[model samples]
Target: MHFKLPNKYLKYGYLLALVPIFFLVRYYQSHDPEVNTGESFFPSCIFHSLTGYHCPGCGSQRAIHDLLNGRILAALKHNLLFIILTVVLGIKGYYYISKAFFKREVVDWTYNKYFSITVFVLIICYWILRNIATPPFCHLAP
Candidate 1:
């Protein structure tokens, strides 16, 4: 008997390939040491750099860096929301890959009205707390 991959399998394979690339980038960033301490190679967040204020995504890179370095507390300090969001996204990605490759089922994610409303409320709260709650709360900003 001969084996051949289905189109769906090929798509799953491509996605799985991204997993390694993701780790590679994480490893490089974690090991480099200089990426975080010095002026980052990427553009500075214009909002923070100029105004000393943070946007919602301000500390995401630092959070990821801390997580990659196995510093959970530090990561959370940088951006708890970013850490939570990354975990949620990672789980969703894993679910899709598993469905596509192993289960041979279509991936479907549905958020009920309550969940949607809760998420919306949480986002608004986070935004207001980060901007207005004072220094320590705003530390999560960036």
Candidate 2:
């Protein structure tokens, strides 16, 4: 199937809308660096609270905060999944933006079922490993 550009308003407007939200997230992460603390405005992960186990997205907020502050190692320590997914999404976003602006056809691996399954399996494994208290697994925790 050919990649068709949507209406101009919807196409560029969506990106324009995201600009403020992006800045808002950056500003919040900059001002409130203690997302892991109870006193912070960010809500605790409900899945983790209910199950007493780290969810796939646990520590993402803190990871975002660390990433915004240029603490790449700390961000990875908080949530490796977040880092990995961010990189993947960034690459995907680049392709999408290029397609929208430059009208270029690129090899988008996201359409492959194997890529989807791999990401799903990775998330499940990361979720389980982060909850395991064993030596190597313990390091995966937030």
Candidate 3:
């Protein structure tokens, strides 16, 4: 016999997948050394290592580690884009959960083209600025 989950139950499968991710992040929070300290199992950015230029995601691992440890500013310092997206995603998650569980009416922004374009532009700008060696842009380096 074959069993198919009902449509209403599909979302719960996604929640179950997040269980392992939550534990992994918790493990990283406590046991993982800072990625910036030059010792980590986390893979170094190949784009940066080979090119000697900061990639758009250069310090994201460190930022995630710091954010998990409640070091908000440190996370922002590592990757401003990551922090901004974290906040944006956090809000989106909150809204999704509230609407799903509580049956609240909500305007979903998930498919907004303008938001997508803005994020793409921001990433490209960040990738370029983070590689610059001059005063203001140098600080953008991870």
Best-fitting candidate, scored by lDDT: 2
TM-score of 3: 0.86
What is candidate 2's lDDT per residue for 1-142, written digit by digit as tens? 8986667867878778999999778766666545345555777789989989999988888888888888899999989999999999999998988888788988888879999999999998898889999999999998
- Measured on C-alpha atoms, candidate 2 has an lDDT of 0.85
Best-to-worst order by lDDT is 2, 3, 1
Question: Against the hidden reference, what TM-scores do the models get?
Answer: 0.68, 0.86, 0.86
Candidate 1 per-residue C-alpha lDDT over 31-68 given as tens digits, one digit per residue, 9 for 90 to 100: 53326556445445787878776677776777777777
Q: Which ten residues in a row have the lowest lDDT in candidate 1?
A: 31-40
Give the clash count for each candidate: 0, 0, 0
Candidate RMSDs in Å, in order, are: 5.4, 3.9, 2.7
Residues 81-126, model 3: lDDT tens digits: 8888888898898888888778898887765999899989999999
Segments of candidate 1 deviating more than 4 angstroms: 1-6, 9-13, 16-20, 31-40, 104-117, 133-139
Off by over 4 Å in 2: 1-6, 33-40
Model 3 misplaced stretches (Cα beyond 4 Å)? 1-4, 33-40
